[model samples]
Target: MITDLANAMSRCRRTLWQDALGAAALMVTLFAGLHLPALF
Candidate 1:
């Protein structure tokens, strides 16, 4: 039904959002790892 479709869409959106956040965190960590040693 319509409700099931809505629920599925919301679940997919949540998963994508989490993935984006995880990717951002990973990028930040990688950038810092590459740059921090030069500052020390």
Candidate 2:
């Protein structure tokens, strides 16, 4: 039982890390899209 719980927690942490990275990428692209037009 404890092992199952640990496995689940590890999986959740990995997913959270992936989600955070995706969110950071999205924010970077969004900011670039918003600011790049002004540079021209």
Clashing pairs in 2: none
Stretches of candidate 2 exceeding 4 Å from the true structure: 1-11
1-40: candidate 1 lDDT, tens digit per residue: 9999999888798588888999999999999999999999
lDDT of 2: 0.93
lDDT of 1 at 19: 86
Candidate 2 residues 1-40, lDDT tens each? 9999999888798588888999999999999999999999
Score each candidate by Cα lDDT: 0.93, 0.93
Model 1: weakest 10-residue lDDT segment is 9-18
TM-score of each: 0.66, 0.66
RMSD of 1: 5.4
- Write down the RMSD of all candidates, one decimal each: 5.4, 4.9
